[model samples]
Target: MRLNHKYFSNLNNIANSSPQGIMKVSILESITNGFHLCCRSFEPVASAHILKELDELKTKTKKTIIEDVEKVKRLESEDRNALNRAVGIWKAGRDAPHKDAKFATDASI
Candidate 1:
């Protein structure tokens, strides 16, 4: 039982030390973390563009759910379905926005 206890202790230490293990598995959470990394890893203009896209994405998501409730409810079935499709498109565009973005080798320079 002593060996098993030591093994579990080592496993716990490894899990606690890693960000992946400590952080919740979530897209928004990951995106926020990515934003921080992007700021440090990219140049000013590149970072600004990437941050702008991410901020717009977050703002659009918030406004769509909170500010557009009435607008969504008033839509016809077909239109509502189209809106849902549009939301999916928006989600798909999230990665596309930064796919072509290049990171600076010496961002701090």
Candidate 2:
């Protein structure tokens, strides 16, 4: 098989960048070595099993990413709502400067 040298070199750089990267790279190398050994030994079942695990890992990672995105969206919405409320309060205080000093103080606070 023709390998993508640039792609693999980039992956290697990423894998060597941090502690988590090191651990992930180590696991990946172990799995790759096992797959090669199984193939050489004519153990198709073992190779298939490794492929299945990799697929499951991909699925789990995707699920986690989706969940994280949802959480970020929710937090952003909450922050926008809060900012709108603050702006509304500030506007109200600015509109009625003499009627209520408390409103201006609360808004500033």
Candidate 3:
């Protein structure tokens, strides 16, 4: 069965609503299409504009990540080093002192 324009348009709406959500959907679609082709011999073709939008979405996602990292770094430098250190230690398998500390800090500013 062919996916109609309405379906893709809905996907575009969803993609525009949230970048992370769009990335997840894109990854899932890619995997599903790959499996469909590999196991069922169904050839899936994406439209050029959809591919272009996906590319733009990826670029925007990377830019957002970079900006977030910069903000995190700024937080780390401005007397929030303790929170950063806590995050690092927690990431390395240690129990964090306060689980919501990072979120709290982020929300504060």
Among all candidates shown, the one with the greatest TM-score: 2
Flag the better candidate by TM-score, 1 or 2. 2
Please give the distance, in angstroms, between residue 33's alpha carbon in candidate 3 and its true position after superposition.
30
Each model's C-alpha lDDT? 0.63, 0.73, 0.67
Quote model 3's TM-score: 0.32
Worst 10 residues of 1 by lDDT: 23-32
Give candidate 1 misplaced runs (Cα > 4 Å).
Answer: 1-42, 71-109
Q: Once superposed on the true structure, which residue ranges of model 2 sit more than 4 Å away at CA?
A: 1-42, 97-109
- 1-109, model 2: which lDDT tens digit per residue? 3336686667678888867785556544645455442334445656788999999999999999999999999999999999999999999978875754466458565
> Could you say which candidate leads in lDDT?
2
CA-only RMSD, every prediction = 32.4, 16.8, 23.9
Residue pairs clashing, model 3: none
lDDT of 1 at 12: 58
Off by over 4 Å in 3: 1-46, 80-109
Span of 10 residues, lowest total lDDT, candidate 2: 34-43
TM agreement with the true structure for every prediction: 0.24, 0.51, 0.32
User: TM-score of the candidate numbered 1?
Assistant: 0.24
